[model samples]
Target: MNNDTVIVTGSKLTIDEVAQVAINGAKVGIAPEAQQKLTESREFVYELVNSNVPVYGFNTGVGANKDRKVEADYYNQFNVNMVRSHCVAVGPEASQAEVRAMIVIRLNTLLLGYTGMSPAIAYMYRDLLNHNITPVVPERGSIGEADIACLSHIALTMIGEGDAYYHGEKMPAKEALAKAGLEPIMLGPKDGLALVSSNALAAGQGALVLYELKKLIQLADMVYSFSLEAFKGNVSPLNEEINRVRRFRGQNESAAHVRKLLQDSYLWIPHIANALQDPLCFRCACHIHGAVRDSLHYLEELMDIQMNSSDDNPCVLINQNAIMSCGNFEVVNWTVAFEMLGIALSHLSRAACFRTIKLSSEHFTGLPRFLTPDPEHIIAFGTIQKPFTALDAEIRHLANPVSMDFYAVAGDIEDHCSNTPYVVQKTRKIVDNLYYILGIEAIHAAQACDLRQEKEFKLGIAGRVVHQKIREVIPFLAEDRNLTVDIANAYQLLKSGVLLHALNS
Candidate 1:
């Protein structure tokens, strides 16, 4: 575990902080003021419970049973039943880091004072993170109209009725709690609903995806720069003055970064490029990558709101002295943003695939076909195109939006959904696939660079570092025995962030 701690203020939780607590094992603490709000909201909930006022998911029932009234005497049993009934999520389970992300995110929002859950439950969330006790949460079973199906498993662990990972060992939730010197929380009114009726399953996974994408985009720029050097491609398209005219932030950022990566390279030696204009994949890479950046920025902004705001139904209003039914749990806005990101990434996948294809073609690079050092004896990158293109095809298919494809549940009372979890999951798959696609592109680019025996054919700063890094794990296609191993190594190299780190260093 890291020695650092993230203090959740209910209003200022950043995605980076989420990653720290989630992926880096940073401990979490609640701000004093936020804890005060949690206490105040719970008091107000008790006040309503005494007054016999009918509140959705409070005095009354939830969903199709909203009209059903619950006696104050039955609050504990009702809440427990609600939690037990909702544990319907199925495998494959989320990673321990992802479950940690979900817990921290939900814990942060509960501090906003809208969820009238017990303060003890809030502290349980903190304890789980600190003790490294992660609830075994399934990654599926929600149409994203709040992720209740998946999140209920988290509540189940808290109540000591489900499975959990105690310090990385699989065990019963009750046993995990005892091993950590903690006890199971008793469910109270609104506690179950507050715990399960959250988009944390989607949001937590999405945050990790976004963190990876930030690195992936940088990796994309680095690889593209190296490929540009191998192709001896024109650098005019990356000229800042030309890109600045369009005023697109993403395009301009990509163009500027590529220029920086290619600094002090022979590609800039006037008229050194092979052709007047390369294919759109090479010429407009910045534009496509820029579109992804733009989409990512949009999603990040929306995610900020999501991570900080209350997504509770029957949100408690301390100022107004009332509890109101709300659709705050609806995440269509950000869900669609994730959808747009997937589409943008599809473009990125295709561009990388095309660039890899071009690198193997003699018509584009003036090198041996398939980047073979010996045309007769070696078949370097010829059949390798099939796997990368197949991955790209899968990306294209995964990019199709599923947000609008849902049927109403709860007697049609819940008629709409964003399918946010699935959308984020699909985006994760796309990012993973891009690594292989870009990795193959790197392999081809490095081989092409080695084949160019001319002294004038030189590597830029980024190309030199990337070429050296790629060759460390994968050598030149000397005799072309087995390329699958090389492709896997390239994937690991790119996914590991070593090349990006080297370039920056």
Candidate 2:
């Protein structure tokens, strides 16, 4: 876990590898090929700037500043000024993982030979990662306008002008570099521009979001399984023949996962039931949940593309006849995908919440009211009520659609946006919310199974595993004085992935 050993060679750096670079113990470095690419791109930019060519960021200005020409002598100052001027982000500092990802991802874009950064500048970033010296990047600011405010903080740290985290402590950039036995280098003509003009912050957020969403989907399925058995719900909706008629790939895959999980559950069989069919949506589970699975798959593909792309502007095309200053900066693709993901995530919360409510309702499962095992224990409410009381409201709030909101700024220069940061942030929050919600469901489900077991009835192997997992954290609720503690304990199981492994098993 040392910072010096987690370098990405570009040969087999998977998604986990990228995420690990963000963690405190992670170390990252550039491969030899990437270093060579950085050297060539830097040389190419230097050649053009020395020849007095009109590049967008080198000799010329940026955005509205595109028309302003800079004196050759002031180029170095301009580069340094770019870092100092744009370090304007304000909000909570990003976690070390996010900052490290920003560094690695920005380095990946530069390795594409388009950013025109000096090899020394690239090596400086590599050294920062290798030595665990990461810039303290803020979590907010920047409407994707060149990521200037965001990356500037990182760039400032590189040249000993900003603050950074070293040895789990925040300190002045100079002091951190000194502690790491390093010296900050000057920014080359294109170094500041190269460092700032990237969507790495957003991209890194998207990458981490993808990682968590993948795990969330698995957890959702497990919770849904536990919830299903808790209600002794009908299972006709999972008929392979019915799913085959739809011919949807994700639907089929979801059906398989559900069927495998429920295969050992004897209580799910229709033995002279009063109703021939159950609610096809939540009861069938696979059909509705499968849609989410399909959507996540699509989002994962888009996220992978986004994470591995160069979403900067005025890409340096040394080989091409022209510099392509395109809309790679727009981020509409990420916006749409993330919003779509938000919708899917909301649906999941809705489904899980409905199941939780159903398990607690006397009209549905014929179980004790609120699945409390004993209703007399329904204590008073207040600032410190039961955990499920707070859990109920939190899950409902998770359904809010952040992607649908809008704000116009800078005289409408950035009129509309997907609010991707909000979307990702909410998604993370909802996942946390669902963890608790499912934990409550786990307790209720296990209680229902215990009730059945006392009657000389039993769930199959799958149900038994789920029941035992829940019991490990929350014992059979003989009398629920404080449901809060049990609810929290159940959530810990979900967060720890112990509940997930049990359900999947």
Candidate 3:
């Protein structure tokens, strides 16, 4: 097999890559000779189910249901029934993108050959992706037990027994399969257990979250650059050598990014002689922001391994001709990383919020209150009229850390769930918050530039691009109409990668 092609073997696909394949028309196929392993595993499972060689999931019950053994004749029906009863997830259905990711994850897990499913199951998933018949899974439920409810919803549609999206239309799974010229597949032995019993959903969701976080980190750096310029804080602390001394890679990279963003700035360089060493919010930005930056990078690696791994329990061993206990399903790795990132993300948020506050205060920044061009409009700034100060406050609130507080539930079976849902949700909320805060910072920076006589304030390569984009959406805020529009415009720029494009270029 050529390594250049991205083979979705279930454990090795990234969320972005998978999305790209779906949206960009990448070819999907089983790995060469993987079918032989699939055949060997299925034969073993079948022999066990028929010859009374009892297995944990092949003929016995599951999790609290393990003690009750099923007769060999009913094992296949038992597996199929297990999926139907577990499709209890409720809420708005997950979008097609998320559902496709779910299919990718499920197929990847099955491809490990431990689930005892026939090759047809993997092919059916491939068929769904090939034809774009995504299941409509719910977003809620599942305490990370491989997202039981969500996976069940996926399984139901796969068997032509549930709901799905067909050619952008919601239809019964059977009807959708018929429309797509496909047929429902039957569960073989432990196939149902293989499908619904792991952390694929969490891993997929976490992987997507990490990808967004990477982009959000870039956005955060760009916004901070705007804040630094607006406050006209000293840039000495961002000197590469200062970060080099700390010997932290992320700190060095973040400081370098900031420097690249602000290097040629007339605002940054022209006033350095008069400015009395920068404020902590501006000068110590790397120390604070860099920690978050490094945390996110570290998290990306951990999540990458998780997303590209098989965490299912009781994996089959074709060579050993037996099943073995493996704790791959345990999610401590992600729990710890997400918890740390949550703390870092929240602090970065508070830092941005406080910096915004300092930019508007006459006590800290001699610039007119809120950095407006006219000091006579101080009251207008106080009321946050015609500007986005009030909106920034709402965005800042999203940074509060809800994941730090833990709770026990699920008869203590899930007493220590990752609470990662809160982590990812809050991280997403803060990303939105950071967008607006950065917008406000840009508005303030632009006003500061104009107040200094619109002297074509110089900026570094990346900063110039970000500054130009901000300028496009918001002209100098000369008179101020509605802050909300400015906030929305800034968010669009942030989301659309104008700032990021500048940094990369």
Number of backbone collisions per candidate: 0, 5, 5
lDDT of 1 at 212: 94
What's the TM for model 1? 0.99
Highest TM-score among the candidates is held by which one? 1
RMSD of 3: 3.5
Give the candidates in order of lDDT, highest first.
1, 3, 2
**Clashes in predicted model 2:** 5
Query: Model 1, range 148-190, lDDT digits (tens) per residue?
Result: 9999999999889889999899999999999999988887788
Per-residue lDDT, model 2, residue 374, is: 52
lDDT of 3 at 134: 78
Model 2 whole-model lDDT (C-alpha atoms) = 0.69
Off by over 4 Å in 2: 2-13, 268-275, 279-281, 375-418, 454-456, 460-462, 501-505
Which pairs of residues have clashing backbones in candidate 1? none
